[model samples]
Target: MAVRKKKKDRRYSKGCNNQALLPRGSKGWPMIGESFEYFGAGWKGHPEKFLHDRMSKFSSLVFRTSLMLEDVAVLCGPQGNKFLFSNEKKLMQPWLPTTIAKIFPSSQETFNSGNSKFRKLLINVLKTEALQQFVPIIGDVAQQYFESKWKGKKEIMAYELAKTFTFELACKILLNIYDPELIKYLFGPFEAIGKGFLSIPIDFPMTPYRRAINAAKFIRKELVAIAKQRKIDLNEGKATPTQDILSRFIVYRDENGEFPGEDEIADQIQGLLIGGYENMSTTCAALVQFLAELPEIYHGVYNEQTEIAKCKAPGEQLEWSDLSKMNYSWKVAREVIRLTQPSQGYRQVMTDFMYEGYSIPKGWKVYWTALSTHKNPELFPEPEKFDPSRFEGNGPEPYTFVPFGGGAHLCPGKEYARLAILVFIHHLVTKFKWEKINADERIVYNPLPHPAKGLPIRIYPHIS
Candidate 1:
């Protein structure tokens, strides 16, 4: 809402002074930029094509390119991952494009910085030990999902069902809103808001970006109403404060002993909603797709889950210990996601720095992806093969298989994914075998993979 400018550079070397040492690549045409080129490749199912193309042409790990709204240096592989992941608020800081930032409850001062209080609070709740409590709840949700949405339906769209399933899980676990009607009501705006993150920034009639911002407003209206009523419920002892994030927020107080405003509460809820949205759902669909395609891999998961079920009493849900013993199954999951990681990560250089003999100017955006490392034959022998055993003992070398990303800024939902995916896989493999309706279904990237026809599949329930 405020016009802002960067302070004079009294700290770092001025203007690409080490231009000779900068990575080699083109920024494409002015204004219109390489955004189209990047999106074109993604829409064609090659989300990493833009980066891979430049890598082969320049033969360099780091290359200069323009993307979205700025000139960025595309950094590749483990070392690149290390630089971006490890240097949070050190040599670099988190970043989002100005146009896209408008869609978020953003402040130019702290936008994507590691110092966000909201992020800190979120991590505190989502980290290792705290997530163990959600295991059975997630397992129960998975069972219900199959019973209502999957079982008895001879054929269904896997991706579409997966999106709804994950959204419901998020509502139940994160917000404590387990009513199906309520979840579906909130999902419409959530779905629309998600598209804006991957769309052109043009905020006009029917544009994805415009729709996204509009959805955010609609979501806030509903969430604010809920939050306001929740505050009254907490004060009157009609609600337990220990329930979910919305309830938790009602009782939380700042250093000044005051509760956050309604808008602030909505923003935090938005943060929680979007945190694992794309990565988790897309990964869930892909995990099912890959396992369905590879019988042997699916068998491994099936065997592991069967053993775990045997250990439990009849009709008991999956527990944390059961989740722990899902090693081979987890390995299959790791391998599946490893083969298809996020398109890329974003970082903004905080100061001029030198890396591997290249001078990276301060303030330039940095993009990193694991595909450079994930697909390298050296890191993974016969990388094309989906051998879950590759993840058996020690797993792929550090930073080489970063499907959930790495370091301080790593996605806080890694543990959530581990349990949630295993829960879904456990139910999937245990009850029935599946087959793809479209064996050659294509993967189109709308910044994330969407299988052709949303991965329609026929569920052959086990013949008892």
Candidate 2:
């Protein structure tokens, strides 16, 4: 919470160097800062409370605070969101907590400087043409996944089950690793990694941080082995360069004509899987939770999906064409994500700058929260209400409804995530009707939002 004092230099006398120009908000407790209060609100399932309370008290669009021992400015509303998203690498730079580097040491450079290149690679693989081929493939996987894990079950934990579906899909579509045993073995470490990202960075043995580091090592070693064999297969003409992301990364060279090392490739693959699985799985779970609560909305989605289903021959999988017709279903999914955005995006100040007359000091962090913007009555009327119709036309203004972020930092795998979600919904609505087992399941954020009881739900198969 310590703000740098004015130095003898005249330039330091102005802008953020002058403490008086700093945003108005308490840093909370020393060292611990407002970390507890900030996260506590999220854990209570009202993350917007933390932002709204401060906004009301300060009467400002920007406020200073501290979290994880770093000073921050919590930027509010669409203007703040636009500034950060539009000024990326200019006024602000993407940042990861120190713990992220400690956990995945080998890929630190990739996470830092090479992130754009990594994103470009992902966009190449997940582009529309590439994803068209995956629609039916994802449908086939979702069908089998539902039949085995969801079919004939009276009640099931939706969030936990959704995690399985997303992880299996990541393994299948991204790495082309379809071995159930290997996928199951890989799942544990990935879960540990997710839990450790925002945990205390103390690396003491048995701590979440230490466990995550060890888990990263285990996953990296396994991925390296996989990448190495993939390289051999590519050289022997047994595998095509475009076969899967694993093969693509093994064969891909940067603009400088440098191919990533096996260890680095492994780290990047792990990053992609972590990024892909966590948010998408949460979206899938939230979709289920929302649909269960609103039978009318669920019925609308069912009608839309069933209409698409009626066109397909018996046992025929969903096609790319069918996905376009899933307009209403996508809107429902969009609303789910808007109301329950996984986590706020973080950016580091690239240089001292003035925003809304408040000085943002270089080296400090900035947080543009989706919950605040998403739930703002100004941007979204009855923001607390579940209204899929809000997304009917052009949708909530450009930067106001950022579920996958915006501009350059926008999630590269957004298309793929959409495809995956729609496929799951298509197969789900067409096959079964489900209701929440717990009428009031709380959502908790372990840095990522998840239903507290894993969103258990009862299912009933539709009559043939």
Candidate 3:
């Protein structure tokens, strides 16, 4: 892949010609060089300020440095996202390659092996039918956690609790791993692998990158063992190959009637661990924060749950059929995801592309910041306000409000994520009434966006 370079123009060295491109930063650094000191200080913490500075300096320009070996382009407004996301073939792969690749190395190979077989397997398993089977399991797991861990608690760390819950749920659904002790052991390496993904990819001794590599190795070993055991069980007929996500993958046959080997299965499982849990857990925690701040929304969700409770028999559990009646809850959940843009859409331009009279040279890192696009006043009026009503009549543009991204690379497990979040919220609202113990709680986006402080809330059980 050849790196794109900006053509020098001595006429506009001091200032930008286009007002639309003003507010960008200076293109002083060499191509592929790192301003590590500034980046390490906190690039994500102050995104708005950073973007403003960059925009002021360059004015719709891409800055490149050889030291860092990456191109940085600040995509602003709705048109920018459309041009980038709509052209999936030209710009499909994400920008955080090192981090993402480190987390799911096997998936990378599977992805490179022509058709994304692992991604297809994930879609087959996590789609509408496959996910329905896990609802009961997810609900039971959440209820147990709430009963055992959060009983009689006035306040709790929302992020930590959400992470633990989603992690356990993901393990059960993806790998069929249910042992608590083993989960604890596995989670440590998983966390390390996640950390390695975002850090500078240097394999020096005692570095985060090296630790992440070791963690990835440990995860692969564990998953390979599990896959082997699963295969043995399937061969022995000890386990009736049910329609779980992993089982579906195990039985999946390609054009040649070939199933993926254990290593490939391990890669997909690792992909689910990193890609599935972090985003959903953050969304879950953020949903709590949104509800805490907006009492009306909170009440609306509770009322939906109440209505569902009435439709059920004395002790009937909530099922997929019941989700239809919870319209308001679903809207609120969608709004939460829309407002809290957990991840950015990243891609590299494979060839020169033109948009709005500007040329996006090949090999440049082109990205669509979901935060900026989702906050577009044209698409989302009062963009900062938490209004679920915006999606009432006709929703925003198709590619504009993409929380799971767009095109063929759209998240395979999006449906599973939605169900898990809905179930968790339903349980929270049905079981207790919560009020924010701390009035001033904010979200922090690092590794992934999450509530900076554990959302501490006072919960009182509903008395009917």
The top-ranked prediction according to TM-score is 2
The model with the greater lDDT, 2 or 3, is 2
Top lDDT prediction, candidate number: 2
Model 1 Cα shift for residue 263 (angstroms):
1.6
Full candidate order by lDDT, most accurate first:
2, 1, 3
Deviation in angstroms for 374 in model 2? Answer: 1.0
lDDT of each: 0.78, 0.84, 0.69
| lDDT, candidate 1, 1-464, per-residue tens | 89789776433335656443667778788876788888888788766677778888975478878887587888887788877777778888877777767777543344565536556666767777888777778988899998898888899998988898888888877778888889898898888887787787888989988999888878878888888988888889988876776787767777778877776777677767776566778878888789888888887788888888778787788877777788888888888787766546678888888877677888888887777777776678887778888886787778788877777777777788788888998888888888999998867777776775789998888764
What is the TM-score of each predicted model, taking all chains together?
0.92, 0.94, 0.85
lDDT of 3: 0.69
Q: Over the stretch 29-89, how does candidate 2's per-residue lDDT look in tens digits?
A: 9889998988888788888888889988984488888887898898888888888788888
Candidate 1's displacement at residue 129, Å, is: 2.3
Worst 10 residues of 3 by lDDT: 14-23
**Which stretch of 10 consecutive residues in model 2 shows the poorest summed lDDT?**
9-18
Residue 372's C-alpha lDDT in candidate 2? Answer: 70
